[model samples]
Target chain A: MLALDIKHLNKKYEHFQLKDVSFQLEKGYIMGFIGANGAGKTTTIKSILNLIHKDSGEIYILGKEMLEHELELKQEIGSAFGDINFYTRNKIKTLTNVIKKFYRNWNDDAYYNYLKRFNLNENKKIAELSTGMKVKYSLAIALSHGAKLLILDEPTSGLDPVARDNLLDIFQELVEDGEISILFSTHITTDLEKCADYITFIDNGQIINSSEKEEFIDTYRLVNGKEEQMDSIKDQLIAYKKNSFGFTGLIHTKDFDPSWDIKSALPNLEEIMIYFSKKENLHV
Target chain B: MYNLLMKELKLGVNPFFYIMPFLTGALMLIPSWLYFLVLLYFCFLTIPNMFAGYKTQNDLIFTSMLPVTKKDIVKAKVSVIVILELMHILIAMIYGMISVRLYPNLIYLFFKPSFGFWGLCFVMIAIFNLIFISMYYKTAYKYGAATVVSITATILFAGCAEWLGIQNSFVSNLFKGAGTEHLTTHLFILIAGIMIFAIFTIIAYRIAIKRFEKVEI
Candidate 1:
């Protein structure tokens, strides 16, 4: 079943405009959204959630149009942001009760189970909780609500190393249920590398590229060579960064000669991000 | 609707907002002569506090993301305003009864306070709520200008009432001969005042819901 489909969504502001931004994610698969801070990641997500008005185009979640089926569409989906998404005056118990009123499928047992696991006290006011605790509570709430699709924007942000790892584990577990899918956005590429099966890279309000994770990682290779070797390779390169020591470029792994000692060292998503960023800089 | 209303109450009913009504209502202990003064004071000061809790938390964007509809959000906020207004009226009326008991034959200096006066307070609050909700929902995401507009509209309502009282035509006729002897006219005035309060409150709800439906977050 289709989880989300954003088609030609358009919105404009004074300094920036989202022009025909579109992508899709299927059920039971995690799609990692990668972008720069001002690259319109939040804008696109806001449009889908209907938090911001869009100039044109259509969005469908679980095969229902957002405008007509707003309440129904929202009921099936859960969302969280990098910042804790609740009022500070609320105690966790009050927050849970409020959420339970809106979600028909709210599972109190699951909520309590998550709180126990996360070491969250139900009576603690949100303002008094630590940042990490707040995020933990937010995720716990999201997971407990029987949400078929989880739309998280930078959920791992501001979390310590241990918390980040624990969250990644929860994400994997959530997907393991096969009924849940995550559309996770993050600058922490390492997190996505571990759990994402698909990726869609956005740049300056446009989708620059998208593909399955295995094929995406396999399609590009870091080619280290001198000027002589570089002269022989230009069109075969998709992205590159160079220094006086030598030039390094990303080439389709299939194009490299088999006779060379070209080891297939797994490139970190950061390396891939730098390549894309530099490529955009070159255009400017 | 209850979900949305509860969310607003949770966020809107902090120490500052919850206590503000009691504190302001206590001012009614001054004199029956100053009752309109107290009510007018309340209509301006209390309504702005509705958005104060929202300011402290910076919660508008976060609140909009939940499954609650935008219309429900506006309704919840207006409900809080009404709640605070009622809290003010109830407490002030209790103080009013105390003043009457302490001085049974005292003639009010400005206009004798009565049930009619308390009912008029509700009308005052309801009108301000209508203007504030209708105006605020249009440009609510805009923090500065929307607040200024709403607050300005609130103050203007008080100004218009003051202008009416200068001649004692509209407000005075309602309280005519309300001094030494109690009158059922005060009862009619109270009932008419309540009807006006209900009508304007309904108008505010209608306008707020329509505006909220089109609000972009």
Candidate 2:
């Protein structure tokens, strides 16, 4: 079963629009939503959560139509953004008490367990917690509600490397039983490279690609060659950068011709993003 | 819906606001003061501060992320406002009764703290809610313009009503003169004011829901 399905999702602001955005995340897996800032990642996430009304589209979560069953569907989906700072003066316990009342399946045992695992003290005010702890607190609340799918937007943006790795481990553990699915949005491609089973890349308000992580990486090549060899594949390159030794460029694996004799290797997620961003700037 | 209301009361409101009514309600004890200012304190202080807290705390985004609808979100907020408004008015009414008992022989200069006058206070708050709730939901985050406009409307309503009581003999008779002595007339005006309060608040709730639905966050 698909945990989430967004079809033709479109939301327009004065200067930006999510154009025909579509993707699906299978249940029991983690899908990385990748895009740079203002590339419609948050906008798409908000649309799926119904925080912003889509101009036109359909969103389905856990096989239920999102708009028609928003409240019910929301019960099965937990979402967190790394930047969310809520009620700074309120203690964690106070906020949790308020949150627990809204969910029908809220599990005290699970809630307490997560608190213990995260090392979150109930008495600490939101203002007292560091950014990583805040993210953990949000995850605790989300997981306690028996959510089947978690949608996280930039959940690792402000964390240290150790904290980021710890969160990635927790994410991997959550989906091990095939009962939970995650759709995590972040520009931190390294985190996705660590745990993401699937990848969906968006650039300039449109979906560039969505597929399994290995296939996604396999689709692009990072080609390096001497300056003399650049002209043969210049038109086929997505974008290229000049280095001290030679020139390096990004190309679709299918576009690479072996006869051209350009040294090429599979591109990493960061390389893909950098090339895509360069491609955008080149047009502008 | 009930849980959402509880969330508002528990997390959204400051504990200081819960106690503010009693402190401000004591103002009614002063003899022949512009009693309108007693309830006006709520309009001036509570609404603005509570909304500012919501804005600063990012309450709207947090609430929207919960398993609730936008309509329920607006409904819960409106319920909180009504609850606080009622607390202010009811507490002040108690102090007003005590003041009237303490100064029984004193001739009142403005509208006395009578049932009819209490009814007018309800209408004033109703006007405040109508303006504040409807306007605030247009953005669902910014409350300064809404608070200013609504408080100004409430003050104008109070000032105009009080001015009419002093200048118009018939208006004065209805609230202060013979009307105060007659339980039926005071009851009628009180009921009328309560009805208006109910109607206007519901209208405001409806308008707020409409405006808030269109809000992005």
Candidate 3:
């Protein structure tokens, strides 16, 4: 069964609109939601969590409608944003005591275990923790409640490389049991390369692609050719950058012709995103 | 709902606020000063600071993250305000009784600390809550304008009531002169005030919930 299924979700603001956003995440896997800043990634995640009201949509988590059963469904869904710093003066122990009471499935043992595992001190004030520790604390709270689905927005935005890698490792280990599913959104594509099982790309409030990690990357190819050779496949290229010697561009693998006598190679997640961003600037 | 209330009392409110009622209630012992300002201290100090704390600490977002409905959130916050208001009034009432006993024969310029006076205090706070809660939830994050407007409305209520007590002979007689001797009248006003408090607070809660539901967290 799908852990999350969003169908035709739409939310409009005075300045921007999310149009026909749809995606699915199967159980026991991590789907990385990738997009540039202000590309509607946060808006989509907020819509799914019901933090913002959607104009129209159907969101199902674990076979239950989100709006109809929000409280019940929230009991099973865990969410953490990278930027939230809560009640700085309150000790973690105090905060946890208040939060744990809301969940019927709260496990104290699991909570204490995560505290030890994450090296979080119960007596420390929230302000004392580093950014990385704060995210870990959020994760600890989320996991202690036996949540079946986790939705994270920009979870790795402001961490050092080592810290980011540590979080990525923790994320992979959490899904090993095949019972918990995660939908993590981040602009940092390199982090996703380490652990994301599926990649969902969004741009300009629209879904560019959503598929398995390898297949999604393989769908696009980066090609390099001389200025003269560019004319042959220029129209087919998604976007290209020209250097003094030649031009490098991105193209759909399906549209790439073998007889074009150009050098083409598989693109990384970052390369795909960069080219997609440049597509807006590409003039006819 | 109980858990949500606990969250507000424990995390949202400071310990100093819990002790503030006792400190401020001491004002009622001043031997017939303006007793309305005694409870007015709550409107002046506790509420503005408490809500400012919620805004700075981002309590709404934190509470929203929990497994509760939008309605429950409004209910819990309103309940906390009521709880605090009751604590201030009850503690001050004890002081009020003591002041009245200490000077039974003392003539008063303002309303004495009687059951009827306590009833007026309740109505004042009710108007404050009705204005504050309804306006604050429109944004659910910004409390400054709401705080200013509501406090002004409450002070206006208190000012008008005191004016009536002084200018109108029947009002002065009821509260300060022969009216103080009427137990049935005091009881009736007290009961009416309590009912108004409940009804107005429920209306505020309903209005707050509707506005908060439309707010995007």
Which has the higher DockQ value, candidate number 1 or candidate number 3? Answer: 3
- Model 2 over residues A89-132: C-alpha lDDT tens digits? 99999999999999999999999999999999999999999888
**Per-candidate interface DockQ score:** 0.51, 0.86, 0.80
lDDT of 2 by residue, B1-217 (tens): 9999999999999999999999999999898889999999998999889999999999999999898888899999999999999999999999999998998886777898999999999999999999999999999998999999998999899999999999999888877776688888888888999999999999999999999988987
Error of 1 at B217 (Å): 3.0
Candidate 3 per-residue lDDT over residues A125-238, each given as its tens digit: 999998889989988998999999999988898999999999999999999999999999999999999999999999989999999999999999999999999888889999
lDDT for each residue of candidate 1 in A77-133, tens digit (9 for 90 to 100): 888877645577678887777667787778889999999998999999988877667
Shift in Å, residue A244, candidate 3 = 1.6
Per-residue lDDT, model 2, residue B114, is: 91
**Model 3: DockQ score:** 0.80
Q: Return the TM-score for each candidate structure.
A: 0.87, 0.97, 0.97
Q: What ranking of all candidate models by DockQ puts the best one first? A: 2, 3, 1
Arranged by lDDT with the best first, the candidates are 2, 3, 1
Highest DockQ model number: 2
Clashes of each: 0, 0, 0
CAPRI level of candidate 3: high
Task: Please identify model 2 stretches exceeding 4 Å from their true place.
Answer: none
lDDT of 3 by residue, B62-92 (tens): 8888899999999999999999999999999
